[model samples]
Target: MTDIFNKIETSFRASLRGEESTDKLIYVWGIISYVLAFLLNKLIKTVHVYFFGTTISAVLICYFAWHIYALKKCSPKKPKLTKEEKQKLREEKRKEFGKKLMRKLLLQESFTKWDPIFISIVIDAFCIAQFIDYIIR
Candidate 1:
């Protein structure tokens, strides 16, 4: 039990530092958080409870924003490559891009962090919008 908590805390701290969460834990966390948010919306039937949705939205927005910032900041600066190396790199990139495009269009697989983060942002925005709608009603 203690080990589990410690590992979770460590992963959280690593993510806060802009590093990826330990292995598969982040996917688990995101799924659990989404389910929890959905349950909260369903079980809590009052307008005041909308605040919970808004709060979750804000937290998620901040987290992904910081995560993106950290990822960009921590990315390695590429050293200048020889022309041949540059050509090889460009060729590799093109191949990778083609693979990704095919995977996205055919297999519906998203391997990049940005895709999930973008989806989360859209959902969070919807949560916020729902909260505002409730308040307005």
Candidate 2:
């Protein structure tokens, strides 16, 4: 983790701050979303699931899963917002961002926001490792 943070700090200091320069931020988001997903999966199994009036393995499923919905509603325009329009848009964007944040935090929606294959591999490895730990412990 420290090494990853170090790498990100290096990347940020050397960044170009453009479209491609988003790689570092994307990388961090990838790590966070996947970790949250796996933990939430286990949490649901260990908490929410029960059978015959007893708690069962309820930590491995998602009920109200988070989902990511892209919003391009605020794309740049040659014309800027009027003050009232700006306030209204700010409120709307605030709500939109809050929902997205909750989804991301809850692992309901992934960073589908990035490369699927890489993300899937990371998730697979995470699951394998978790199963291994479960067996060993």
Candidate 3:
């Protein structure tokens, strides 16, 4: 209804401003994209193979450009570190990586970040749709 649409619009605006988590939006979009792709394919009676490819490429380019822009705009300059300090930092990162890997393996960690999940959902939907179409034909 109006309430649902208002929430979606708010979320979309917030996401555009990098002020909101996009997990729900990405999930909803993934489902809608897949459904629409199927319906469009059926209605048109022909697949536009380049359409999705071009769309994905353009999205990726824009995403990377925006990411670079954000990083350049918001990131602090790195401090110059002494050799010993650099080594210590690297050792700490190594230990942290090891612990993180172990935690992930044991399922003690949960990912709340949305980007990887969003990308996987998109790729999976595309692949699954292509597979289903292949089977139907």
Choose the strongest candidate by lDDT. Answer: 1
- 1 or 3, greater by TM-score: 1
Rank ordering of all candidates by lDDT, starting from the highest: 1, 3, 2
Clashing residue pairs in candidate 3 are none
- Where does candidate 2 stray beyond 4 Å? 1-20, 49-137
Candidate 2 achieves a global lDDT of 0.46
Error of 1 at 124 (Å): 3.6
TM-score, each model?
0.46, 0.25, 0.40
lDDT of each: 0.59, 0.46, 0.55
Residue-level lDDT of model 1, residues 5-80, one tens digit each, is 9987876676666565323333555556556656655654554566665665566556545444444443445698
lDDT tens per residue, model 2, 79-117? 777999989988999889989988989999885686543
Tell me the tens digit of each residue's lDDT in model 3 across 1-137: 99999997786566556565444444564446556655754543455566554554444444434433333333334699999999999999998998888888888996444554446445554545564454444
